[model samples]
Target: MSRTATAVPPQGTPLRRHGRTKIRYRTRGLAWAFMAPLLIVNLLVIGGPGLASFFYSFTDWDGLGSANFVGIANYVELFTSPAVLSAIQHNLIWTGFFLVVPMSMALLGAFLLSRVRRGQILFRVLFFIPYVLATIVSSIIWRQILSPTAGIGQALQGIGIDWFADTNFLGDPALALGSVAFINNWQWWGFLLVLFLAAMQGVDPALYEAARLDGANAFREFWHITLPGIRPTLMFLMLMTVIWSFLVFDYVFILTQGGPAGSTDVIGTVLYRTAFSENRAGYASSMAMLLTVISAAIVLGYQLLRKKLKWEV
Candidate 1:
């Protein structure tokens, strides 16, 4: 005869629940403890300065002495001021150029590289070299290369090329902004290529194989398989491109100093001038606030897009 066994529930059911709750609390406490140092550093470095800037935006402080609350006066002036408007327009142009030129070049370069077998590492290293170069160093180098008197133009002129011999790139108002953008793009697109290449490598090899089996050409393979596979990285880089374009100042400041009649004046340059050069720190703070708002809006918009579209990245 077989004997039947009866099951007994766990003893001290309330005790187990309490024990689990206590463990969870302890784990959370440890996590917070581990995060405390980073939180404090971030607060001191970013949060503090950000808050001070926000406060200063509403005041008429000249970077010294007492601050008087102006109550959006600076904002009104910022919107109406022609200099500010011109700077904003330049920034928009910069954004447009970066979003189109570098992004396209990077995508094409990365796609071509992804198809190559030999010398892939060599090519990647060569392309990434420019990105590793210091901004000031590159700006100085380009400035020399573009100089009408002693630069490549003159050197080429000695070889019977007169096309660029007399062209004053940074000195001409018409070409200053575009020249700066071009220089920045030279240093930027390589980095984008590397990033896009990395993203492409993460794509499933099987997808490309399947497309090839279906008699897909190189362009078709890239369009159908590669682009979709790397959409997340592409979109992210585009978003950052917009933001960084608006914040661009280093090359412009170093190369042209927003000169040739403010042709290359960006929001960043304008802010620097208004604050330090013009000694209108309060107004500059307002400009800073505007930049902050634009950056935050872009981020928030991206977040909303991700949530609405359910992006896995």
Candidate 2:
């Protein structure tokens, strides 16, 4: 009572607490050690170049000289440039096409594949094979297949079919953009199919069974259960599709080179031309910044939507 019954410390308690603390610190240190190499590499590669691009965007650097600060002149030109505007318009069209066509095809294909009890693996392999092919290889193959003189058109003409006999898919300004998109989609939708199939496989079978018991048809079951189950993957892929559509260069560059009167010219091709072909690196940098800003805005909009919708995914 006199000394408030001076509480006796539990023996080894402090040591036990200190041991846990030391272990936590050691664990954290080990994790950082494991992450250090990758972090350093990203900082050097991605971060450094990103910072340089941002700095050069405001300048008038012609790729090999002193960067003279021009303060938004490049940005102004980037916005006002006719070629850039045309490229952006094409990019928007491309984004719309990919957002609809591949996504729909993949979703339908994946859903059907999910119901298959046999030969599913073979189908998957066949579908994914095109996606695994190198872009250049696929582009070349499609180019040959779409050739006006010796391609499907000629093959069909041999069979007394005159539908595509005169069609120059890649050479016609009206057809070039669509032709490139179709070729890209041929290699793209399959990849999306595989991913959607994987995501669908994770959906609960019980839900489908319940839907069936409630007399729900295939489409209804898919609409209610399958879609919600794989929404996270769906949303993520759509986001990436939007970003990638803006950055599409490979297929266009290889097959069309944004040719046929620049009908298929996208932001990527324009940026390439500005930077290397035209020796306007600063203007190209500003274009890069525009792409970055657009991508960032899309991501931020997605985040806001997700938050507002209280999406658990």
For each candidate, give its TM-score against the true structure. Answer: 0.93, 0.91
For residues 5-73, what per-residue lDDT tens digits would candidate 1 score against the true structure?
Answer: 225446557988899889999999999999999999999999998998999999999998788999999
What's the TM for model 1? 0.93
Off by over 4 Å in 1: 1-20
Cα error, residue 158 of model 1, in Å, equals 1.7
- Which run of 10 residues does model 2 get worst, by summed lDDT? 2-11
lDDT of 2: 0.94
What lDDT would each prediction earn against the true structure? Answer: 0.93, 0.94
How many steric clashes between backbone atoms does each model show? Answer: 0, 0
lDDT of 1 at 229: 94
Q: Which digits, one per residue and each the tens of the lDDT, describe model 2 over residues 81-124? A: 88889999999999999999999999999999999999999999
Candidate 1: residue 293 lDDT (0-100): 98
